[model samples]
Each structure stands twice: as structure tokens, then as C-alpha cells.
Target: MPNAVSLAPAVSAQSVAPAFHEPLHTAHDDDAWWRSSVIYQVYPRSFRDLNGDGQGDLAGITAELHQLADLSIDAIWMSPFYTSPQRDGGYDVADYCDVDPMFGTLDDFDKLTARASELGIKVIVDLVPNHCSSEHPLFKAALTAGPGSDERAMFIFRDGTGPDGSNPPNNWQSHFGGSAWTRTLNDDGTPGQWYLHLFDSSQPDFNWDNPAVHAEFERILRFWLDRNVTGFRVDVAHALVKADGLPDWGGRPDGCSSDGYPGHAAPMFGQKEIHDIYRRWRSVLAEYDGDRILCAEASIDPLSRLVNWVRHDQMHQAFNFAYLHHPWNAAELRGIITDSLQAFDSVNAPTTWVLSNHDVTRHATRLGENNPEVGLDRARAASLAMLALPGGVYLYQGEELGLPDHLDIPDEQRQDPTFIRTGGERVGRDGSRVPLPWRADEPHYGFGSTSGGWLPQPEDWYTLARDVQQTDPDSTLNLYRSALALRKQLRLGAGSLSWAADYMDTDIIAFLNNDVMVIMNMGESDAYVPSGTVIAGSHADAGAEGVLAPNRCVWIKLN
Candidate 1:
């Protein structure tokens, strides 16, 4: 093991327990904090490593609480640190109530939450109720109990087809690729029943039809709530309840027609039964004193269908994926924002905006396409525009530094199941999930004292390290800090958006939120700057001056 580096003192949960239980942000209305809160997504394994074990842990997160607090984020939505098999990056949960040994113990998580609470940052943990690690004791017990037993009934288990029962029950495909079903072995080493796993075979889907499954998840929610988590980000929120009878999707021979959604009908998702689960969860959140909330990771299409998850009785917010997946064109973005506002407004729910997360190519690389400098500029512009919108926002870790996807990860070191299952035909999400760079001169970019973290970082990241960006006034990190401060000061999240219809058809996207004018130039040529005192901009050259540069966005204070 690498020699342990000293860390800031950790505040014990016992000492802070009394104050931590109380609400931290009394400045914001308790009933509406979740509506427009700026939440930062913390992927623990890639965030920071306190121990010299090459993987980030709870202690690392606790040590960084002050950094998030300084960023002015209202809450931190942590990715899973629960007892997991490390498959799917902790999404393959083996136990719901405990932290993984790799991440640290229960007390360590308690300390992390306690520190976060003290910093006025609410903790919202990831909750994967749709499935569990196959190695979980419950799953293992189901296997040992054989078919038709009470334990086996808790998970979706169906017999295979063909003469010797070799094929999967349905034609559904795994998100990671190949068949969605994995057959189990009997006592005699013969093929037994097949279990459904939408993502990977190691993560078996739960049978929500079973009341025992409901009871278990309810208990899991209470367990985390009792530990003082503000809320949950429900994983694959649209996928808990599969269509009745598990019908073949859209009569397609291979059943892989529409990627994640499967078919036009989407038999595997958007099922009506899923709402009842959220309704019950909403009630559970209501039992808590804080404005406990649920944010859905439902990848449902068409803003209309997506709005259902955020009805008053369900989730507080669902990710506005239409905005995330839209092209960087001004017209496309304008259309998506308009649609998102209208659709979400019908349900009286806030539209959550996110530019990049752990699952996709970072916006810096994605928007720039081929040019690195251009990508960084566009990313900054996008951040400014996203923050100006009227709703909650999620800032993926390292996004503030304008980090691009580390596209050069060696094939041998790749761990994502999507990469392995696809035989490297597709690069998968590993590029975007690389460990963050904290310091330029330190070992492993200061991720850990000993190593460069679980995944390799690009050498170019030295200049982009968090410390490097913090010192530079014009750096993307400082840009985010400035924008977040202004966002809070102006209460932009609580405001409403109004389009500058005169520029609607042009390549410029101009809008007003709470009397602050926001404009972006997506045209081929530089556009004449609008009449206003330029307050904040995506580029250093942006000021009360000549023209707004192409691929840049600006926030103006109109007199």
C-alpha cells in the first residue's frame, strides 16, 4: 500500500448528529428547495482518493465537502457507495443498508453526510430499486431455494424455450448488448430457469409484482432516510415494472429495434404500474421533515411522456433529457427548451437541466466534435445557458473544469460491461468516467498519493487540473463559481424564461429570465452584441463591446 497521506480532520457523526439532523438551508423555502436546487453529482470512485488504495472513498468525499460548499451548490447527489460488487460502478448493489468495504464503513458514510450537512449541502444518494447484484444474499437464497419458492418469487424468473430449454424467455435485449436473460444452473448442473437483467447478467431484475419486493425497497428507503439523506435519485426510474406477461416487443424478430426503449410501444418501459411505486415513495419522502425529494433517471422520450414522473404525487424532478440529447444548434436548443418548459409547466414541475454526466461523452468533446478549443468554448457557453434556465441543475463532477472525454483509454484497461460485451466495437462510457485531476505536480494528479486512480488520466489534463483552474481567473472552474454565485444571487432558478421572439428564427438564442438578458450566437458569423451591460460571459473577450463571437453565450444586465 502507498504511504497514507494526511487528510483534514473528519467530524465524527456522533458529535455533529444533533445539528446535522436540522435543515441547513433556511434561507430557501422548505417546500420548494428541490424545485430549483443546484445539485452536484459526485461519482465517489473518480472524485477523490483519501486512502492510498487507488479508489476514492467516503473519507475523500468528506474531505471535499468544503469544496462543494464553496461552489454554492445546494445539494450533492452522490452516486452509489453502497455494498456492491463493483460491477456497473456500484450500481450492482449487493446490500442496501451498508456501505461497500471499498468505499469505507457505515460510520464513514455517516461522517460524510454529517460533514455535508454542516456545510449546508444536502445529501441525495443514488437508489437502484430495479435490480440488485446477483451475488446479493437474497438473490443467492433465491437460487438455493429452487423454482416456485418464496425466495425465487421475489425476482423475475422464467423458464427458457427450445427443446432443452436453452434460449431466453423473451426477445428483449440487454442495454449492455446481447440477450437480457441469463439462465441459472440447477443442482445437477443442468439449465434451470432464466432471470431478467436489463443491463447486465450480474444484475438481476426484481419482480415488482411481488409485495415482498415492495416491502423490502420501502425498508431500504427508510434506512437511508433515517441516516439523514435528503432524498434519492431513482435509477432507471421508468423500468421498475415491466409490461404484464413480458410480451415480445413490437413483434421484432431480434427485439433490439429502438435501442434503450426497445420498440414503438416500449413494452419494457413507461408501464403504468411504475407510477404506483413512486406514489408510495412520495408518501415515504413526505414522512421526513426536510424537503426530501426524488429525481428520476428515466430516459423516456418525448417531453410529454417524461412529465408524468414529476406529477405532484410522484418525483420532484425528472431529467430533461431532450435538452441534454439535443444538438448544439441554436434552433434545436431553443425548440427543446420551449418544449421542456411547456410540458413540465403542465405538471407544475421544474425542468432539470444537465449537460454531461458519467454515462455519456462529455459536452466539451461532444459539442466541439473535432476541435478541442472549440469544444471547451462551447461547453462554457452551454454551462452559462443551462444555469440561466428556470429549474434545478445537475453539474457532473469535473464539468466545471471543462473536462473532455479521455478518449485514449487503453482497451486492456477498460472495465465497462458495454465495452467488454460489445467486443470494443463501441468505446462505452469509460472515456467520460476517468478519475479527476486535482493537482498538477502531485502524484496521480493528486487523486491518490500512490496511483493515478482506477482509470488513467490524459497527460493534457495537467493544465486542466482543479487546482490549476482555481488559480486562473478566466478558467472554466472560476467561470462556474462565478455563474453559480450569480445564479443564486439572482434567483434565476426560481424565475421564468421568456424568449426574444425577434431572434427566434435567426441563429441567435435570446431569452430573459428574471429581467437578466441571456443570448447565444450559434451563427456562422459574429453577431452584433445586444444593447446591454454585459455582466457574465463564456469567453474573456465577452464584454460591453462590439460583437458576440460565434459559439459563445453571454448574460447581460439590461438598463
Candidate 2:
């Protein structure tokens, strides 16, 4: 039957893709591997423990590379494990070259890289460039120099008497709360200048305007590439460049001061100059051997701006946060997916999808808090929706096990800087950072030997233990394996595909790619699709008619 729909032929054995063989610098090779890559994020603090220190380290992660390999993940995007004062849980990096003591030494990191390579899993580390800890040597030098010093220019330092000394140089708010600036004592016992921090006071903003800063960052990038790091997950990538001249962000209606220090919206965070910075970074990454991935965590609203980050020459893929924050509903889910595809199509850039991360509440907790069965079912559906997409897909740790957020931490035990400064009005991130359960019947739930791990393990984690799930034929782990294998066999990432919104109405979203129709039932009731060859699904058997039960998904191949 020669119908309008036909399956695209697989890549020829002799016709090599340009990205795989060419140097990364060539336009033909940029963003080559990511198109089909499935990235698995590992939050080190909670992944595993090797030394019995109650904290996960490089050795622990290295030992578990086989586990990731068994799941068929192509790459691992690890959160920052750099040296830090633990102010922002490793986000505020003090040194880029060295591994944090708590995470083991540089040798351990190298061994982990080698082990992951052996398992065919690429390693991507989080790169924090926008800011450094207040204790960083560069910031310390600026503090001692006071005003009119060369080292002081490395940061945004303004004297108290900016015009009249009554107002800050500009209006900007810290993300945590209150002003973004903090005053320190000068060597002469006089009022010292104020330093700016977009996040917390302890994380002082870097003066990217300084050439020294640019050169240092370039060196850091090269250092990692030389060590065989597969790529980087750029942290707050859009915030790298700010307005050359600090300006007032106008007064806030919430009664909080909008003065440039913190808490107020400022235009400098996403300046146009950011593109130039990215180009320079990309140029350096080109020097590497393989197709090095660059995933940006640019928290920009307005889907159009987000698409810009993934254009031909920009980031390989920028995090799509629409699904993370959207309300769980049939219409909302359909709209987000449709809009995302349209936005990416408009820009000719591939799209990426992430349902949850360490920063946000667990998806299970968000959807299953009231009805566990429904929530788990919905979680499975969401995973299917994301995996079937055209571009890359990211799976946060414990997502496969259906782990929910654990919010039983005492107020005094809180560790997140956001919670500490906000006074508990907002839920902290501790709930999502709990240890992974390796065994259901172990005394400590197989997290570690200690009664209390780095973060408290959820009581419910025992049921979702890795050992138990490995044995269950219908477990989420097996489902992920099946989905990944199907995707690989189809080679959809390298094929030309088009989707129509008319077929994707509320409660049901259907899209066609390379002769494959992905039908998703976002509602609670069963849905039907025209008969086709079933490629993958949650059902035990695939009948001629594609009937999907509540929160079910099926990929059908049309002849």
C-alpha cells in the first residue's frame, strides 16, 4: 500500500552523519549527538554513597554507572560537584578546577569519567559562571582593596556616595529577598563599597565586563575539555552578561524597594550581549574531539526568547520549563506541547523537555498527593509524552521510581538558602534531594548504613526501591527501557517530521513523525486511535485497534 505516510529509511551503514566524524567546530557537526540523546540527571548528594560518609561521591556514582547503562541512558548530566562553601549546595562555586572535598578528589572524578565512557554514557557537568562565593579569592582581593583599586574592578563595587549616597546606583532585587548589596568594613575603618549578588549575599555577582574574568572562564572551559568531560550544563546561562551601565528598575508596587540591590526585576539579566558570550564559549567547545553537548538553564519566559537559546549556533538545547510550572490538566498539557513545537519550528531549532528537577517539587508529589494510583498513572503518561518528542529528553533522578517530595524536614534542619532567607513561606528543595533507595527491605532502605543520610530518605521510598523495581515486569524502570529502545530503533531524531494541531484537541494529543503516530490520552478516561502496528505502549498486548486506557500512551507505526 503506497499511502501518503511511509516510514523513513534508516541511516545507511556507509553514509556517516557529519556530526559523528567531523570536528565540533564545523557547522555540520554542531549539536550532532544531542538530537537523539537521552540525558539522565544525577543529583550527587542523593545518588549513592561509597565511603559510608552518608553523602554521595564520585566513587559512588562511578560504581553505579552499570545501573545507568542497564537503563540505556545515553548521557548523564550531573549537578555541580565543584568546590564550594555549601552556601547554595554547590551552585556558588569557589574554584572550577578542583572537586569538592566532600565529593572526593580529582582522581575520583577522572575515574568516574572513564567508567561512564566505558558504559557508553557521556558525562556532562554543571558550569556556574554568573557568580562566585563571597569567600572566593577574587572577591576577597576586591574586599581588601576597598575603592580605586584595580582588583576591585573585577566585581560590581560602588561607593556609598553614588550621586547623593541616599540611593543605590540602580534598582535591582536579589532573587532570595531584600537588597542585592551588602556593605563590608574598609581597611581604614570607613564605610566600604557594596557588592551585588543576584541570588544570595554569599554569591557575589561576577563582573563579566572585565577581560580577566573572560580569560579565566575560557581557561576553565578548556580545563574541563582537556580532562575529557563530554559537555557542560550551563547554569543560569542567560544571566552571564548584564547592562553595561546599571539602571534603576523602577519602583515596585509590592512595597519592597526596587533599588538595584535585589528582589526587583531588572533588564540587565538578559542583555543582548549574552549572545556574544555564548559564541565565544561555543568557539572553545569546538576545540574538543567528540560532539560536546551544551545544555543551558536559561530561565526565560515567553517561549520565543527560549527558542533563541537553541538556534543553529547557540546552545545545543535549552531547558524547557513550561511543563514544569504549568497546571496539570488536559488542555494545559496539550497547549504547552503544541506551543513548544510551534516555537521551535519557527526558529528551526530542536526542542527539549523536562518535567521535574532538583529545584522544583517532584512531579509525583504534585500530581499524586491526593490519589496515588492516578498520580503514578499520570506520571507514566507524562514520561511518554516527553520521550516521544523530536529533540532531547531529560529524566531527573528517581523520576522512574515514582518518588514524591518529602516535606518532613524540621525548620532548623533546612539547608536551602532560599528557605533560610524567605522564612519558610516557600517550600524548600530538600524534599526532592532525598537519597535514592537501592533495596526495599534494607534497614536504611539501602540509601546508606547511617540512620540519617545526608538528606532524609522518604518513608515511601522503600516500596519504590531499585531492587524491587528491577524485578517487577511492569515497573517504571522497564517502561523507560522499552520506550528508549523503541526510539532508538525508529531513529526519529534524524528523520524529517511534521505535526498537526487539529488532531491534538483537549484531553488527547496526536502527532505524526516519520510514519509514526504518537497518541496520548491526557484525560482520565480511555481513548482510541485508528488501527495501526503498535510499536510501544503500557498495555500488555497490542490489538489491531489502538485503545488506550486512562493515562495511557501508544506509538503506532502507519504504513
Candidate 3:
């Protein structure tokens, strides 16, 4: 049965479906692959588990390369699998050069990278430069080295303000929650100076002002580069360089922007000094062959400010958070797409589009509101819209399967620091990071041999498994595969986009790219289907004559 929405109008005669083909994408410099590539974000712990350890690992990722290659993506960006305490989901790096025991060993990563290369897919690992795990040797040494020691200087350490030095150095709030500062115990077992942690207390922010810190990260980068990894997705890229003498932002602990920041002008992020770090990284990447890349997870706003990080000399790509966080409104999306293109064009950089990731709610749940069916339809429609944009795209794992955030995750099972820090006031990101469903009838939906992985999978996920969708043309997985195949065939990622004429006043998003016109109806009622040959669509009724349903997207080839 077609995954058609109830609101879709009855089908009449089919439109004149066209038979046409465009030349393959134009050739560019070897290092320019990232300019228009589709990179998949693999959340290691939840993707697949081959070891039956109840968590996904490197070997599991290797086992799934064939499936990823089948999707036609250019690369895979795996979230951190480094040796860590697993606090903050491996963002807290305990050892930069080794893999966590739970994930696998260094040899496992080597084999995974080699297998991925054989399938023509490049690998990009996560680099957490903004902070390190408290269990890291350096951080551990810093804690015992006292306030004024060189070991302590690697991180943000400061004297308290009160007479007895009891108060925190500043009132900055952590992204995880509560005070950003955590006091330590001196050698004599007395209350020592406070150290800063912009995220969880287990992850202490590094002081970029220290030259040794810079040298250490450079060494760590080379360690992986020598291992033949393509590049890195720099974690917390914008927050690496804080303002001189970290001042209080006066922003409340819970006051976060759509991109999860305390406003764009927060003193702790987007500091000018951050560019120097990227420039250095770019230089480091230039030393290696194969066009190694660096993608920044910078959430800086005002497209103008965010563009600076992707300047020709700095980083290859910075995520387009503005576009990701926007609602399903046609006008809003148009403005953001236009603004993003213009802003990135000014810097001679490609705008990266992403809808969901490890940190945020899945787009299906987010766009659907209370209606599961509506959300799935809109999510599919949104994917069509995002893929039509001209730039790099980062697809979070399992998004192709139309997975909703596991919103019913039990409170006791929640592990995100945000949940613990906020005392359940905010549910945190555990829902988005749940293990993926690969097989309908297998144990844990084929994630592992057990009943479930770390976080529980929704019982209803069986219907959405890849094995079930592979045979259904109208399934979300099939929709993504068809759209991706077309994207590559027509080279849409490298094509130019222009707003189609005549629909400017309507609630429909109509844009033309090369010989293809992408139309999405975001209005309350059915709208006229544009006159053309239907090529692909987000819904089964997309090829229907006369009208397009609300939250439906279709690609048409000019007659």
C-alpha cells in the first residue's frame, strides 16, 4: 500500500512523467569533494551492535558499510568513539588517540576505516577540542596539581570571588545545566579554586590561551590523520575560545536559543580567537593527501557571523543550524535558504543543511507536533526540500527510516546529563539517540541479541525496520533511496536554485534547479500540481493529477 496521507485528493489521470537525464556532476579539485557531498552522521552507540554488548561499536559500523554505500552518500561522520568515560555520550574524551573499550580497540577502527574506503566512502571522526573527560590523564593531573600549577593552566581555573573564596568565579551557566564552575579539593584536602565546565562537570573546558594545549591537540590530530582518517567533525567548534576573563552573560541557566545557546552574543562563544584555531587545523589538513576536511559544529547565528568559520582559509564546512531549527513554514524556509546561500556564497563556502542530529529532537517528532502520521509525512517532505538545496548535507543516522524520537523513554533509563542536571524539567536528547531498528522480527529489532540496546526501542518500530521498507516502494527508506539516486544522477547538490515564478504569493515552496523543479505545498489545502513530468515525490499520491496535498513534496522535470 502507498504511504499516502488521508488529506491527499483522489487521483485522476497521471501527469506526463518525463524520461530525461543530465550529465554527471562536474569535476573539481581533489579536495573539493566536501563542497557538495552528502555526509551521514553515525551515532556509534545506537547505529548497530555486532558484539552483543548491548551497544553499537566500530565493528558494527564496518558491517553496515554496504547499506550506507547503497544510499549513495559520499561520506560517514561518526560521533566520537574515543576512549572516554561515556559521560556526555563520548564527548568527554579520556584519550584522544585510542578507542573506548566498549566501542572497540584501535585495530577495530583501522579495519572499519579500511572497509569504508573499499566501499568508496570516506570517514570523518569527531574531535572534541573544547573539553576533555575528567578522567583524562591531563585533567586528572590538573586536579591534583593545585590552582597555580602549569597542569591546571591547561584548563580554565580561577580563584573564587567571596572572602573565603567560596563563591564561583563567575555566574556563567553550563550548557548541561547549573553553574559552569566546579570547585576542587587541594592537596591538603581543602576547598581549592574553581574550574570551568561549559558542559557537564565531567568535561572541563580547555584554556585555548595555553600554547601547550594547542600543541597537544595538534599532536592528537596527527595521531588520527596518520591512521588514515579523512578528517574530523569538530565538536563545540565555536566555544573553543572564550572571551578574555570570562565575564557573566547574565543569561539564565535555561535561557537557550533555538540552536541551544544563550543568545548569539553570549560571551563564551564565537570569540574572534576561534578562527585562528581553524586556520591552524586547515593547514594541518593540507599536509595530508586525499583532500582531508574539517566540519565545524558551530551554532553561531546571524548567517553573517556563522559564515566566518567557513571562510576559504578556515574550515571546509560549518553546519547550517538556522535552516535546521526553522519550522515547516514556507516563507521562513525560503528566507533561511536564501540567507544561507547568500551568506556562504560571500565566503566562497558551501552551506551545509541538516535537519536532525544526536543533540536535537528528530525532525519527524519535531515537525509532526502531536500527530505521528502528519509528522512522518512532513519529515519526508522536509527531506525532499533539504536535499534539493545546493550544498553539503549531513544526515543523522536512521533519519532515512523516518524514525521518531523515542519520546516514551522511561525517566529512570534517561542518561543525558541535561536530564540529570535539570532534574527532569527538560527531557534531554536520549530520545533522539535510541538504537536504530534494522530488522522487524530480530531481537532488539536486530540491533543486538538482547531485548534492547542501551535506551529502549519503541515496540511499534518493527513496522519501520529497513528489512520491511526495502520491499516497499512507498516506504520512507525507499523514498530516500530514490531521491538520493536522483540527487546523484542530476547532481542537484552542485546545481543552482531559483524560485519558480507564479507561486511567490502562495504558501507553496516552489524552486527550480537545472531541469528539475521542486515543489512543496505547506498550505492548509490542496494546491495545483505544477505542469511537468513527475520524477520523484515524498508520498505515493505525489504523482496524482491536478493537486498536491499539504506537507507533500514532488520533483518535476520540465517537459
Candidate 4:
């Protein structure tokens, strides 16, 4: 370990128990913190390493709870840290009840949870119910149980087509590429049965049609919830249920052609059965005292269809990813924001906004065209704009420090199954999954007890290390801190958004959220900045007295 440092966030009463009092912002004025909390996501293996193992673990996370507390966040959403074969970054879970050796033991997880509760940070974990590691005991049992046996019924196993069962059972393709079905060999070395995998062959899709499968997941959820896990972020939330008979999607064009719905749909996704599963899962959460939440990573589009996943008692929130996936443009943003807020409103569910996460390119690099200066500007601009709109927001771990994607990651250092499976034609997500820089000048940048990080961080990351950024008041780190403080103070998340149609600058996006003036200058020239007491911003840099510099967003208090 890195010496015996106290893992507690702070020594205050607020950090120890619920007895401590803190000012509650308007929107979050209610006890349902899930509706308005700012959740910080920490991707394991890339977050911090406690054992000098070059991989992040629970102890490392416990050590950093203090830093997260300083950010004024209500909870931390952790990506998968369960037992896995590491095929899909822990998404391919081999066991649901235990912790992976790489992430530390269940005892370490208990200590981390206890420390987090003391720090007043609720913990949420990633739940990959759609698939499990092919090495799971159930899969092993299925492998030995022969065809048409009870052990094999929990997973989708079918006989192949063509003469002598030589071909795959279906025409479906794995989202990662190649055939979705993988044929296993019998004791005599004959091709036995084909099992379905939506992503990688190492992850076998469960047979949701089997009641035993549903019961197994319910037991798993309760196991975590019993350990005081506040909630779950369901991965592939829209894809649990496949269409009847597993039809071929190869002929149809990509997107919402199957159901003729307003949103994108596929035979493999947005199925009606998925909602019923959540409804059942919701009942399971109801058995607990705390208002446990289920957040969906449903990538459904066109707010209307996506809204269904968040209806009344289903998932408490579905990620509004359509907003994140939209191109950085004025009209596109306005429509998405309006539609999202309105659609979720109809269902009485809070809309969850996330700009970056473990799976994609960091928003900074996505907005910037191989230009750091331009990317940081746009990234900061979008942060305030999203935070001011209302409801809950998720912050990817390094995002507050303005960390950009490490686009030039060496090919050999890449470990993502996507990259390996595709033969490097696609770079995979390794660029965005680099270990976070902590101490400015420390070896391993304070990630572990060594100089080399698991994935090499960019050379310039020292400039954006959390330690350096915290000291620089004008840094993006400080900006996020200030904005979050202001957001809680002003009850911004409790408000409504209205367009300032009177502003004539097409390059600028101006709006009001509960009487707060929000202006984002997306143009080359400075746009006229409406007057109000400036609260928080990307920076204080200005052009003229009443104009905002290009690619900056400002929040002004309404008089």
C-alpha cells in the first residue's frame, strides 16, 4: 500500500454521518437525491492503484473519496469491478456476488463502501445483466450438460443450420463484428451447440426467456443492494430482450426501421419485454428502505421512444445520450434539449445528462479538431450549458480537469477487445481510458507506486493533473468546482429553460433557466453578453464590456 493514509474523506460530521447538515439547492430540496444529484463516474483500472499493481482498486478509490467530496458531488457511479476475464473491461462478469482480484477483494469493497458512506457519497455500480463472462460457472455447467439440458437452458443455446449442424443458427452479427454465435465442441470433438453473444464471444448472452435467468439477476441485485450499494447503471439497458425467433437484421438498414417508431429501433433492441424486466427490477428496489435507483444506458433516440424506458416506475433515469451524440450545433442542441426535457417530463422522470464516460472519446477531444485550445473551450462551454438546464448530471472522473482524449496511444499498448478483434482498423476506446493523473510531478502521476501507468498517459497530462489544476484558480478544475457550488446555491437544477429568442446572434446560444441568464458564445466573434451579476463561467475572459469571447459559456444571476 502507499503508506497508511487515512481513507476518510474529511473529519467533519457531514463526512461521518447523516447527522451533518448542508445547504440543499431548490431542485434537490426533496429527499429523492437521485433526481438531482451530480454523480461522478470512476472507471476502475484507470482511476488509481493501491497495491502497486498498476491497476486501480477499491483501496485506491477509498483514498480518493476526499477529492470527490471536494467536488460537491452527491454520489459516485463506478464502472464494473466484478469478477471477469477482462475481455470487455469487466463488463463480461464471471461472478456477480464477488469482486475481481484485480479490483481487490469483497473485504476491500466493504471498507471502500464504509468510507464512502462516511464521506456522504452514495455508491452506484455498473450492472451488465444482458451478458456474462463465458467463463462463468453456469456457462461451464452448460458446456458439460450437453444439448437440451436444464443447465444449458439459462443461456441461449441452439442447434446450427445446414446439413450436420455446421452453420450458425442465425444470420445475426455481433455488434463487435463477425458471427454472434460461437460453436462449442463436444467430448468427442464434434461441433456441439451454438451460444449467442451480442458483443464478444467471451460474453454469452443470457436467455431472458428463461425464468431462472431473471431470478439469478434479481438475486445478484439484492446481493449488491444488501451491501448498501445505492443503485445500478444497467449496461445495454435497451437490449435485454430480443425479438421473437432471432431474425436477421442484415438486410434492414441501420436505425428505427423495425418497429416504425419515431426513435431508432432494432429487432435486438427497444423490445417491449425490456420494460417489463425493469418494472420487476423496480419492485426489487422497492423492498429496500432507501429510494434505490436504476439508470439505463438505453441509447434509444428521438426522446419520445427513449422516454418510455423512464416511465413512472421503470428506470428512474435513462441517459439522454442523444444530446451527447448530436453534432455541436445550435439548432441540433436546442431541439434535443427541448425534446428531452419535455419527453421525460411527460413520464415524470428526471432526465440524466452525461457528456463523457468510460466508453467513448472524451468530450474535449470530440469537440476539438486536433486542437487542444479549441477543444477545451468547447468542452467548458458545454459543461455549464448542460448543468444549467436542470435535473441530474454525470461527470466522468477526469473531465473536471479538462482531460482530453489521448488520440496517439501506441498500437501495442491497446488492450480493448474491439481493437484486437478489428485488427487495429478501429483504434478502440483505449484513448479515453488512460489512467488519471493525480499528483503533478509524482511518478505514475500518483496513479500507482511506479512510473509507468497501465495505459500510458499523454506527456502533457502533468499540466492537467488534479493537484496542479486545484491550485490554479483559473483552471477548468476550479471552474467546475465554482459552477457546481453556484448550481447548488441558485437552485439551478430545479428550474425550467426558456430560449432568449430576442438575441439575434445565430452563433450564440442564449437562454434563461429559472431567471438565470445563460449565454454561450459559439461563434468566432464575441457576442453581446446580457447583463447580470456573473456567477460562474469557463473563464472571466471577455471582449468588450458586454460581450463574451468565442467558445465560452457564462451563467449570470437574474436581477
Candidate that beats the other on TM-score, 1 or 3, i.e. the better one: 3
User: lDDT of each structure?
Assistant: 0.84, 0.74, 0.86, 0.81
TM-score of each: 0.93, 0.88, 0.94, 0.92
In candidate 1 the C-alpha lDDT for residue 326 amounts to 70
RMSD of each: 10.7, 8.0, 4.3, 9.4
Q: Write the per-residue lDDT of candidate 2 for residues 298-345, one digit (tens) a residue.
A: 877668777778776778888888867665565666567667767876
Question: If the candidates were sorted by their TM-score against the true structure, best first, what order would they fall in?
Answer: 3, 1, 4, 2
Q: Per-residue lDDT of 404-493 in model 3, one digit per residue for the tens?
A: 999999999999999999999989999999999999999988999976689999989999999999999889999999899899888888
Which residue pairs show backbone clashes in model 3?
Answer: none
Backbone clashes in each candidate structure, one number apiece? 0, 13, 0, 1
lDDT of 4 at 33: 83
Candidate 3 global lDDT: 0.86
Off by over 4 Å in 3: 1-31, 252-264
- Cα deviation at 341, candidate 1, in Å, is 0.4
Ranking by lDDT: 3, 1, 4, 2
Worst 10 residues of 4 by lDDT: 14-23
